[model samples]
Target: MDFLHSSWLIGLAIFVVVFVLAQSMFFLVKAIQRAKVLKFQTSDIKRVMVSTMIFSIAPSVAILLGLLALSKVLGVIIPWIRLSVLGAVTYELPATINVVEGVFGQSIGQRITDPVLFVTVVWVMTLGVLPPMIIIPLFLKRIQGRVKNIRKKDQRWGEIFMNAMFLGMISAFLGYVIAPRTDAVTGESYVSLLAIFTLLTSAGLMAIIGVIITKFNKEWLKNYAVSFSMLGAMALAILYAMLGVR
Candidate 1:
């Protein structure tokens, strides 16, 4: 565990961070140059950039929450680097849990002390994302072309196909959240009320936000709706724990 936060790990994380920042800056400069060549107004560009930075806050907060949750078991450095880089909480948390609990037969809440187990997790997390990176670049255009062709043939079916895909992805996580877990000590299975309530809280918050956006015409709320729902649901989970709901 000491090595998890060692100076070498910190240094590697810093290098990755710097490289990502430099890459972003390179793209930003190129974008600005292209905008200037296209005769876009400087003020318009500035406003767009400002709005983008402001809109990024909502997702950033969600990432921060993910980092905090993962840090409890994995420590801060790994979660910080993972969340900062090409990983989302949805993927990272599950990947970690699957390795820690499923593969290693260990508790999720306990800190991982075995070096081999830690490396196995790091490799899994790193390699799991590579396929998407490779597949998207190699086949995304072909996939999109097929989707466009399908839409031209029957727009309703195209929409349904896309929605179905999205729902299928979501159902995997939903099942995990609602599934009954057996207590280790008691050898009994029980549904997690906390998970069910948290799920409902987030869904309800999102529903309320959607209604407000549609009825009140608060178009700007779209940017923060997911963040608000996630944060609100997390807060409720904390409150539930404090109130002994579990």
Candidate 2:
């Protein structure tokens, strides 16, 4: 929404619409795709979705608590600390927009007058409601079929779970601080459509690990998963942060 760029309200409007669609649309499609590909049952995904949502959301909780905790405690250590650097994803929306326009205004609009809409549209395509709308379900389906029956002896699966959760939390935390945001004159403060893409990009690492867990030995993926996710997420956050969103 061009209206969102000029104001936070409009961005909220776009976010509301996009959020509902993203959470639901991809839930089923991803489930179906993963089930078919993995030869699992579509109906079984109900539990998978529930489980993944629970596991993935944990980091979000941690992020919130971490921010509050960090603010009160760490703020004492580094008196100049600002929320964005140490806060959750939602807090950084304004910074994301401001940095993008201030830093890349010319090149962004060089080819067109409505660079706002141009970026919004492209971002939605690349990062909007598409990835989760297509991935979460697949991931859940994999969890349902391949991971359900593993016993404690399967330390391999345990390591895989730990790795996936670690990466998911890191992404979620950064996403809170640096997610795409837009506001409009209509009084809506919203995250951008690009959030979907960012989520997808971050989730890709988890997806890959999940696949490996299902077909390969966990020890290999485990030893390398955290290091890889850390580097990848850092690069992604910097790239997007510099990209500065509309």
Error of 1 at 121 (Å): 6.6
Model 1 C-alpha lDDT per residue in residues 1-246, reported as the tens digit of each score: 398889999998898889889999999999999999999989777867776676577578879999889887787888888887788999999999989998999998977788999899888888878888788999999999999999999999999999999999999999999899998899899998999999999999999999999999997677667777887898899999788776
The local distance difference test score of model 1 is 0.88
Clashing pairs in 1: none
RMSD of each: 5.4, 17.7
The best candidate by TM-score is 1
The top-ranked prediction according to lDDT is 1
47, model 2: CA deviation in Å? 30
Model 1 off-target regions past 4 Å?
1-8, 22-83, 88-129, 184-187
TM-score of 1: 0.62
- The TM-score, computed over Cα atoms with residue i paired to residue i, of candidate 2 is 0.26
What are the models' TM-scores?
0.62, 0.26
